[model samples]
Target: MTAAQPFVQEGPDWPGLRIFATTRAGGVSAAPYASFNLGAHVGDAPGAVAANRARLRALLPSDPLWLDQVHGTRVADADHEADPAPADAAVTRVPGRVLAIMTADCLPVVIAAPEAGVLAVAHAGWRGLAGGVLENAVAAMGVPPDAGLRAWIGPAIGPLAFEVGDEVRAAFARAAEPPAGAFVPTGGHDAAGAPKWLADLPALAEQRLRAAGVATVVRSNLCTVAGNDRFYSYRKEGVTGRFATLAWLVP
Candidate 1:
């Protein structure tokens, strides 16, 4: 197995805060789900996934509170919820309570309010983004969004690779006015001949976070589909494993 190379947070440093997202490197799963597959529900060997988690745990303060991501808006309270539940995002104020969100092509959004001692992570696909998952997570933190809250948009399918249909665009339009250039017409069509537009996942996420009043927003600018060798991308590989993004207060 290769050594794990996770993307560690570098800026807007807050005291006692730890945040990072894993790459596709390291661990011991075989092809398709090859090395470093942390997801248990993605058809990877159970033993392999367990081993991967164990490896990841060795680097964390405690076993992370993993969520059952449903591409919805539910936010789990990691400090109160002992068992994993069906939710797309999680929030915690207690130090050592590591919160995790698994994703491949979907965006992994990490939010922190150092002053309030709160941190949250969300799994945001187009559906969740348009459905207000970020908004919900920010609200769950109990800290005013405009009050020094910062967010990071982790790797996901970039705009050039994330082609979508009118329905997808309509969803964001129905929810809120998306950023002016969030969706750009590709002047192309899919197998069904439907018009396609490249949707910028990170841009959409940034817009939402800013609209929610987050004081600082940063994007990894890493494209999963484009950088599939280093990051898992379901959009690029149909049968693939997932990587995780985690955050916690340093204890």
Candidate 2:
């Protein structure tokens, strides 16, 4: 598989930070995984995954600090850790150290406090988001809520494509002032008469970031399920590969 240029996600709002989220367009994996599958645990060939990482490393300062995400609120310190940690989020205040979060349908959030030399990447599926992964990640940065911080919400299952039952809706309702329009009724009911919903992962993420004191929040607008050719969507295909979102400071 050939190397596909990463979709770079950087802007003046996040100066001194270099960020990129991979697409499924480039690499060596075949068929279901196609190419550019960065996840090692997703049944893809180890060599293919390694080659893909090597290709990705060409554009980074160092290998990304990966995590074993458990859909929980644990946040790991990328700079101090020796190996992959069991956490949903990874943060680092050192330069040249990449913090990565793997996801297919789950929302990939990268938060940065450039002025403080801090960066964090989170894997936020419904369970993680509802359980306060974002809040824990922000708190781990050691910066005040009002600190000059910026966040970018990467692609995930979009609202129109994400159908959930009452339990999912109730979780967000439990949060403080869950953003309006974040969850829309699907005009359908479950077996228990509970209203079904099409949850907006990005909107929900933005709301969480705002509540955590992030001043500016931007979303990739790329939907994994919608852009099947460009992204790996686990919700769309049960047995599929996982792409990643990586972020680090410029040394």
Candidate 3:
């Protein structure tokens, strides 16, 4: 019952590189993740999804090097690779090639070393974030730990709407206790009522980036859960599609 939004941004915050995130708009995908289903592993019609990708590719530097996106810290060398690789993040120094990450609720992060001509994309789904995905990606860039890197977060489940179980809280506790604030206890109750917790994924990611030697970070105020009409949220729908967030250098 809602109208479609457009695929756009005011402008990329990453200088010397092209960076963009896909919205849940302007595509052929129908129903759940209607239009612009950038995720291939999510069970959408391959033909339709490919068509949507083709449409999206028309606006980028080149076909994006997609990832399998396991919730791990593995980083892929997609700089010149032509196929999808099993990794949580991707990095490239080659010009005209794109590195991308997709998510519905999980945070999609874009990293760039403009001076170093390095660009990367990561899927930070708490597991990946806590497991050192950002650190891995930046380290893989070979830019030296002191070389300042910049980053930006794409739309994902915001803190106000993201609730988690004790186990989830425990995961963050193992990584960094300070980020515990990203999670708010729901109160002691059952699984349905047991104290759930709200998570601020962006804040958690920023902390990781800062700790990883990244100095500049830009963030979008978009929340996938609250902006379903503009984003593709798997949590919002039982079987929804995916949108894309990409970054690349122009030849």
Candidate 4:
């Protein structure tokens, strides 16, 4: 990893597994998508995106299966699927098959059940969370009763920076009541005067992962909105590049 290396390698020290989150630090892109932007659909130059991806590819064992995330609860089978597809999450039991999710402010979650030889990644925004993206990913992993899974929640909009409306709160309630303190009233309102609250995205993700039987859930606690210099932030900049969070089992 050099000063120009784009990834911030972090995750469990488990054997035969590799995980990391990319930063918008080194690449050929310019301006709003300034350098290291991996998302091809975010309006960055196709060639620049490709060049950046090539840089990332050099560091991996195989090409990553990048999903066309739609903020929905669809988990792809990376072991079988060879091409990029429309899904917010992907799981694979095959070693060396990399799974990647691109996000600016949305949560990027990496999950691994080494004993079961399963690895998964998810792109969870509020909508994805309410729609059970995390739950679906964990279910897809199919870890044995005693195998146990551990997850690492990556950079996303922090609690204090992610303001939401009643509908957002209600969405969680309808899906599965969030743990207390997940949403704190901000005592503010949108243009329509609708009540606003600061939602803890990481907390919400941890709650869902635990409910789905993950044994250990760790958070990076890195805020994209706050640390805009290192990570991209769609909420802070409507037109911005996306960073990637990836996971794979060593071959």
Candidate 5:
């Protein structure tokens, strides 16, 4: 692992699995995107994104299955080669085929069921969360109902910084009925004096994962907006790069 190009390794509860979350540090990209922008669609130079990806590829067995994430709940099975599909999540039972999700503020989730020989990752923004991206990914893994699945919630806009309108709050409440603590009404209000609530994305994700039969769930406790020095933040910085969370079976 490159010490300067920061990445956090996920715990080893699921055997035969390797997962990592990269930070904004260490790459060839210049300003705005800066040194280590992994996302190519976010206005970063092609050469810079290529260089950054090539640098990241050194840590994995193969190139990652990059998705054209549309903030929806579609899931792609990464067992075969295909064009970047329109999906928010991906899964694979094949060893060494890396599943990657790029994000700045949206939560990146990595799921593994080593006993079942399956692994998956999702790009879960609020929209994807409300629409069941996590559930879809779990289903796509093809794990039996009795299978033990675990997940790690990666960096995103944290609760304190994620201000939202009543509609956003209502969406989660109406659909999943997540815990009250997941949606905290804050002092901040929009122009119409409508109260802005602080929504805990990780908390909501945990609830959904549990509902979808995941046995264990762990959160990274890293916030892209707050940990700006380490991760990129589209919400905090309008024009920014995207870091990635990658998971695969250890060969």
Candidate 6:
């Protein structure tokens, strides 16, 4: 889609997938959510948000089915493909149907079953991931577990920078296929005699995808916690905005 340009573009490595991750640039949002903030719930002016959506519309193959993401594992049909729905993930077999997922520190995973002519996007924060969001998405596609799904993981908080509590750790462990290193003991030693253990959200996310048979994975390794100018982190900033990673087939 032809809205704000992507910091990274489609590479020769990615086949049968049109994907890009957003940066905090080229939009008209202001203040805490300053510029290019795709999320409307984060308190940006309605007009500016609409204009930003327009920019995204112009660039995508078709109107994107934006989600009212609640950080759950509920997969639903795309807005254009069905009705305006509430779901954390979306998949499509039809061409020109874009499956877009929004994220800041959380990982946004784009899936493509090239042979089956399908694509999907999942918004997986720790809550969703712990609740089987990715597995739900793969199941929603009805592609079978061995369909050779290709995935591209977008920017998110790195494990080293992400600090979580015991509750977050318990959530994953309770999940059927828990990812390892989701959280490390964050209370060893700091430069000034402090205590902390960092989490590796990206690595954990990759492990989840790999466990689900998504062999082809491409990750940007861009950390929202570290990159303030390019990304918006709710954890980093209590009142922050969100960027998006969108994917679709060219008609």
* Runs off by more than 4 Å, candidate 6: 1-13, 79-81, 176-180, 188-197
Residue range 1-251, candidate 1, lDDT tens digits: 56564344333355778878887777789999988999999899999999889888988988899888899999998888988579999999898988888999999998998877888999999999999999999999998645689998887899889989978988888867878888899998877887788898898898889889898898888888874578788878999999888888987
Q: Between which residue pairs do clashes occur in model 4?
A: none
Tens-digit per-residue lDDT, 139-167, candidate 5? 88888867888999988889888989987
What lDDT does model 1 reach? 0.86
lDDT of 4 by residue, 1-251 (tens): 45366657476677778988888887888989998999888888999999999999988888989888999999999988887568999999999988999998999999889878899999999999888999999989887646778999998899889989989999988868888899999998888988899999999999898888888899988998874578989889999998899889988
Model 2 Cα lDDT, one tens digit per residue, 17-80: 8877888875888878878888899898999889888888888888888898899999998888
Writing each residue's lDDT as its tens digit, candidate 6 over 23-100 gives 778887888877788887877888988887777677778877788889888888773446656788998878778777
Quote the lDDT for 182 in model 6.
54
Which of 3 and 6 is ahead in TM-score?
A: 3
- The predictions' CA RMSDs to the true structure, in order, are 2.3, 1.9, 3.1, 2.0, 2.2, 4.0
Clashing pairs for predicted structure model 1, backbone only: none
State the lDDT of candidate 3 residue by residue for 1-251, as single tens digits.
54244475433555687777878778888777687787778788899787888787777767788788789899989855667567999988899888878888898888888888888889999888888899998888889766668888888899888877767777877877746478887665455665677778899899888888888888887888884578877777769988778878766
Q: Comparing 2 and 6 by TM-score, which wins? A: 2
Best by TM-score: 4
Q: State each model's CA lDDT, in order.
A: 0.86, 0.86, 0.80, 0.88, 0.86, 0.76
Q: TM-score for each prediction?
A: 0.93, 0.94, 0.91, 0.94, 0.93, 0.87
- Candidate 3 lowest-lDDT run of ten: 2-11
